[model samples]
Target chain A: MADHQQKSDKTVHRHEALQKKLALKEERKHHNVSFIMMILLTLVAFYAISSDKIGDSFAVMFILVLAVVQVFFQLYIWMHLSHKGHEFPIWGMASGILIAAITVASLMGMIWTS
Target chain B: MSTHASHKKRTGLMDWLTTVDHKKIGILYLLSGGFFFLIGGLEAILMRIQLIKPENDFVSAEMFNQLLTMHGTTMIFLAAMPIIFAFMNAIVPLQIGARDVAFPYVNAVGFWLFFFGGVLLNMSWFLGGAPDAGWTAYAPLSTVSAGHGVDFYVLGLQIAGAGTLAGGINFLVTIINMRAPGMTFMRMPLFTWASFVTSGLILFAFPALTVGFFLLMFERVFGAHFFNADMGGNVLIWEHIFWIFGHPEVYILILPAFGIISEIVSTFSKKRLFGYSAMVFATVLIGFLGFMVWVHHMFTVGLGAVANSIFAVATMAIAIPTGVKIFNWIFTMWGGQIRFTAPMLFAVGFIPTFVMGGVTGVMLSVPAADYQYHDSYFVVAHFHYVIVGGLVLGLFAGLYYWYPRMFNRVLNDTLGKWNFWLFFIGFHLTFFPQHWLGLMGMPRRVFTYMSGQQLDTSNFVSTIGALLMGAGTIVLFINIIISASKKNIASADPWDGRTLEWAMPVPTPEYNFAQTPLVRGLDALYVEKTAGNGKMTPAEPVGEIHMPNGSILPFIMSVGMFISGFGFIYANWYAAGGGLGIVLITMFLRSVIDDHGYHIHKEEVEADIKGGRA
Candidate 1:
């Protein structure tokens, strides 16, 4: 699963390389699109934060949502986490998020003395 | 990118100090953990002796508090966790048919960090006082306590916890990426499954402790109050964070113990594990539920009814998965050819003892009921039954079961019997009466009780039991020495073992497998034994094997951590900064140097295979 070794048959190997080139092109397109969208998300976040019409809490939530989307783009495109051999890293991040959520929930719900 | 850099094999102390081999590191873990276990046991004995008679004053109340705190801290952090890691490091790679863990260098670094951290924690005894704020290090009390005791606790655990986190990630990666060709998720041996789940728990859990410790350290060292209620900080935050880590921490210890039991039970029963998939599911469920129930530990703190009820129910729900495991073990033995070896005896013993502990656990989970049991001997007995009766027994079972493979000498069976009976009977006698003592209003962590309170006889009996347990440990130490010198060489598959680990030759090679064994199914070795000749079919032909080079940098890095931790405890900024600088320099050197590891050539591997030596 880690590797797909190329065989020494010339025509077949050339076809395989052609397929890989198409896939790379597709991935590059995705990366470019995500980069543009990420910039747009950041601008939207800035707007939410600076706009006078936005309530303080609403702006915070709006920016937080944008940040999450931006993080997905950054991780999948910039960090190449969308590539193969990234399952365990994804599992780690998901579990960390789960536990962090639990910790924040408990701290907010139960710990305050006031 | 690979190169064959020939180097001389290290011998004696240098071999031990610099070696990145998992086997040697496992033994190092065992030795250090065993040393700390003895220290913790001694502390337990002293506390028991102090409480032997009503109003006994052999040790001062202050001393008793220190002993209690250190005993809990040392046993949990330095002793039990490291011992668990020892078995994991020693056995998991072999069981998975991998040559070594994914990150051998990090593994060495983890071990040394733990060693230095434990040493730093113990140094407090010679310098001033040990941490008297309990293992949990609850806030307010931990914050207000005088001296550098809790500082040691904070800094030492911070270093140790970092090591444990690294270890957890290493195992997670190793198991995920390094299994033999045919090993699949469901086909993995139960011990590996247990270790996988335990590592996940450790990964998700230990960071909470690191965060908690940082807060506590800041409050103590820098006077940045995160825990002191007097400074408008919430003390309850500390409790929440600690138990957030602490609760899963117990599971981290016991889950591997559960794994050990699973292996020993099936091997001794000479059967495939009953409900293997259910067992795996239960193990994972237990690890997941472990985090949800930390609030139960704080039930008596007057969290609202809703909060208490939610956590209470969550706590009780863990018993369902645990119960599934208990029944699976029994079913595994049912109608099978059961051999009552020392390890098997511990596995058999663990079931009922753990059940008793579970019953008490459920009882304590009732928030209303817990008010009475809070800070009482009942709580002590409850946890001891689970920890000592459950985890310790499983560890002993693991030690006994893997002893042949580890040391290449069978421990004297007669001595094993003596050790088991003494320890088993002694453990029960020691903790059983504490339940009644708690019910009779004998509060725990106290130096003594008044005479005629119905606690005297129980205390005495408990002390006697402690002595017997101590004696049993001594007998074990003697057995290890005698057995090694006797040189009673064991066969590779001693006890007709069923796992992939048993497929190896005795004194496992540094490269664990010459040719990675193809794992066909659950009990892969058993499948081969029954279907064909017992040898694993090699997944690949003999080939050059790349192996990691051993370096002393991990050792040096750990020493630097120790110095920095110590410096932080005393507010010595120069020492702290200089020590950290040393660590930074070592890491930089490691990165800049091109230490392309050497390889075991195909000829050498072929020779070993032909000679039946690998």
Candidate 2:
């Protein structure tokens, strides 16, 4: 009877240890998610009041801002761009975006002027 | 490696016609794209002939406009982009050590969509007229364009655009999910980097085009006034949206060329790319900045000076990154054992020509200055300088570089030199005089000019140049056919290259690798070679390989849209309504269908590998 009681105590202790580890991970995740959401919400609120062209300008801005956040989310979570093992594609894709931006902006400027 | 039992499972033209192999799919892309390139070239030649002399009357004014429109659209969308994609599709998955692209069936579908769309667009010629709407198919004019011309533009691009978007998604997924063990992101080749970025641009940019095309359809066919000025609708909005898509469209076209150039330059020069990280950073910066500057295209349309000035500066900002890239290329060639192969010559030539293009681009960015340059031969000159000097040159360079790998035969150097010089001299001859004409106040798109307008001589020169360019293009075809027929197989490492692609065999196998390669570093093959390891270490054991089967469903899906296209154009209520119904039904069927695909048995695979039929 005493040995059986000892085994039960050990099992309980192991379960507690696992629970603590899981709790710590969840806490970190929550903190990060809230931080991102809060920043995004704050920006949207500020931009909503700041712009005169609220419907079009701020709306576009908001969409773009949202897209930026989404890209970050995609890179980190969906694309795993931040995954430790995936340096080449991450870097390559990033460069591609950079060059693409220049091409669009330059042409836009030229065409707008022309 | 030909000892495998399944090594000789099938061999025939039928097998190739029905094959779902990524390599084969890539070859199909090449053949189809090549065919279109020829057609576009012919269009270019016709355009040149029309402009040979002032009041030449070689072709009708209306015909000239359509020719110009189709020429631009076909070359950029159907010819260049798809041909580049052919290479990317053939090589990228292999470079990354994957068995196939993320979605093989979609890959096949994408190619077919392009093929059919190009055909559909061409069929407009037989129907009545071709799309006279400029490649951009700008709003007011496009909506007002009579006949079925605009209809072809809208429907053809939409169909093809869907295919292109699918291709982008597939590449993105493949790169994301399929890298082999130790093949980290930084280790991928610059070309793959380009494909990834190009795909991303396609993803975002195409949707804007989709929106634009639909609005155009509404106005032209359905009697909507989205772009009709009299109906409280703004035509400029269409311009905004079109350029929004259109401006980035150049990047979509050129950045991949830059990627190819980087690979070729480094390989032939026998050195690592100078400023590799910086080059990467610049590419990304360019892509990000692409969306910010579409307003520049609208300066002459009167967006006010403040908007114009900001756009000018934004436009100029692009040059800094471009200049950096140019410097990087120059330095890449510096202090290296540069082999002046046909590809290398093109790369070297690109530096000066592209830089000149860049300078002019910056000059055009100035709103006040563009007032002088806009709608003139100068504008044509600047764009031709960029597109021809930058993208087309890079493509030629890449073709020469990868020719051996693609066809297993080195393009004859003597013929290549002829091709390059004729193209080079002819290009300069054709465009140089245009700058002078623009300076002399010649407006573009004018079908004819009166004598003593002082434009005749330069125009004549321009026509002569165009003819030379045509002759050069013909020579390129000749070189391709002769070399292809010779069938001298490319070595595994044809250029003594740095990237992973050179590590693989010529005529790469269906499975890509019998086993996925375990990459240790950048230029992983080089590392293996130096280590006296003759073969790449396989990351995993050979086993049954899961692959998607070839299907007729994608073709059917496209045909549904192709048929519905007429409905939208004819504006027959039944056709539009029922035609759309067909599309909806196809989608529904596609979703409901269960496609588990197929798998090659391990025994067959082993036999193939042993026989080297893999």
Candidate 3:
């Protein structure tokens, strides 16, 4: 009975190890995809800013959009914000961004322009 | 790190100076905060005496200005903020079933920084003069003010504000990460929930003040052009930034007060807080809205009609969440068995008093009306109604409610009641007539008024009332001293408290719980009493407890900051460099040192439990 139990334990360990390996591979795939996408977005932003075809105003807006997207990729893939137990960090970041945006917009509009 | 010699706790003054225990630090906050409260109260009484009769020269105009600035700064920053911190440090961890704050070292650092910073600010009285540019310290006036008074304000608040920010982050992390098993976010007591939101407000709000202070400091010390309009800097920017921080700061003060009232009212009424989830929702909503309504403070700044309307609406919208809270408190006591403990009286008093403040607040929120009310005695009446009537009363309630937990003695009930009535009635008498005085064209921050303006009677009444309030405060001090001296120990569950904090043994152990409590539901202790065994189930088996070692480093670091503040104020480079060097050296030492902390062994914990001291 002891021998049988040991064999079953070994099997469970092996199964878990295999599962971990597969999950690691999947995570690597996701990271690589996000990395490539971020690189592409940065290049596109550079093109928009440098290219003669894109207007200055439109390019500024486009690059801003790209920057925001890149930030999400960095947070999710590199910082692992997509992982479990990151709800608090996400809430914190979101609220912080909201407040910062409001403050900048109002201060600029009220003081700088005026 | 695990040396047997480190197992013994330090005692006496050395213990307090080196202590990192949350409870000890809390006591330190309370003691320092109480001291500052007295100083601020004295300043207020002096000002009242000056204003007692028309054309009275009890204090010079310059003296009154300094007194006014120091009074507002001290009461808000030194007294109320630290006292709120006192309760937060003492109660939040126990409520959430945690051994200590998440970063105990940082907690100590925060306290000492605030302490030294307050001392530095007060030291201005003897050194040169207290800041006379008003607590708001609007730009060019502060920038061009003679002497080092404003410099003290800039540096002292900057240092103190850093401490507040550290404390805020510590509480946030503690609440988010340190709850015992089954103590979910939803199950957290109202005070803990309120603290969590207050911490969030502090996190976002304090940085604005820090930036404002830095700009002001640079302009003052380094001759920077940040707030100098002639140097192409706009003075309005200072106002904007100050209010941005200042508005949420009021919430930061009052939210914890709201939480205290909620706890006291519910506990004394023998009921679970009515609309628990709604209360939590309202708290979060209020916090969010607090940031949005900074512009209301600036409505008279002429940001434009559109801006005023938008901010005005946002300001009024906050009333919705505040109303929700007020009704919830009333409903909490609707059908329950209400005990008129001192804490309960304060809580009951808070309900109507805070509502009056809120009513006046809504009245002031109208920008068109604010044009008439701006910088008037009406504004003073409105804020005093909220701050003194709302927050101070709530603080008194918390002191009575949590006295047993902090020290194993209940305050004297009869004396406590006298303290309440005197304070409560005096508060009304003082600020209630200020509204009429404002309407009758009495301005704030003034030394004296003309004799025949119909303001004399109100001013006289207000002065007498201020004296009564001062007397009430004295009564409370006597009550504290008298109660603490008595030998009769309070039971573990004094007042039949509903939350986990009340479940501890009479003299709380250095390690709060002998074993981690497995929280079952909202009002965890009460839930257990009603449905299961009348005790918290142990989440873990008996085990050794690891506690952080007391360190003097936080004290040293704060001393360094205090020195740096002086250096900046006086423009002494060597002092600044030396201070910075001291801080850096301490940081280096802390990084390299490996103090893994000592442990209370399992046997000792078991013995404590058996002795009824855990």
| TM-score of every candidate relative to the true structure | 0.97, 0.85, 0.96
Can you write out model 3's per-residue Cα lDDT over B421-513, one digit (the tens) per residue? 999989998999999999888889989998888889999999999999999999999999998788998888889989999999877788998
The candidates' DockQ values read 0.65, 0.09, 0.73
Per-model clash counts, in order, read 0, 46, 0
Mind giving the per-residue lDDT tens digits that candidate 2 earns over B396-471? 8888888776777888788888888998998999898998899889888777777888888888888888888888
- Over B347-429, each residue of candidate 1 has an lDDT whose tens digit, in order, gives 89999999999999999999999999999999999999999999999999999999898888888788988899999999999
- For every model in order, the fraction of real contacts preserved is 0.82, 0.00, 0.64
Query: What number of backbone clashes does candidate 3 have, counting pairs of residues 3 or more apart or in separate chains?
Result: 0
* Candidate number with the higher TM-score (2 or 3): 3
Say which candidate scores most in DockQ.
Answer: 3
Query: What are the lDDT scores of the predictions, listed in order?
Result: 0.91, 0.80, 0.93
Give me the displacement of residue B255 in model 1, in angstroms.
0.5
Worst 10 residues of 3 chain B by lDDT: B1-10
The docking quality of candidate 1, as DockQ, is 0.65
Q: What interface Cα RMSD is found for model 2? A: 7.2
What residue pairs are clashing in model 3?
none
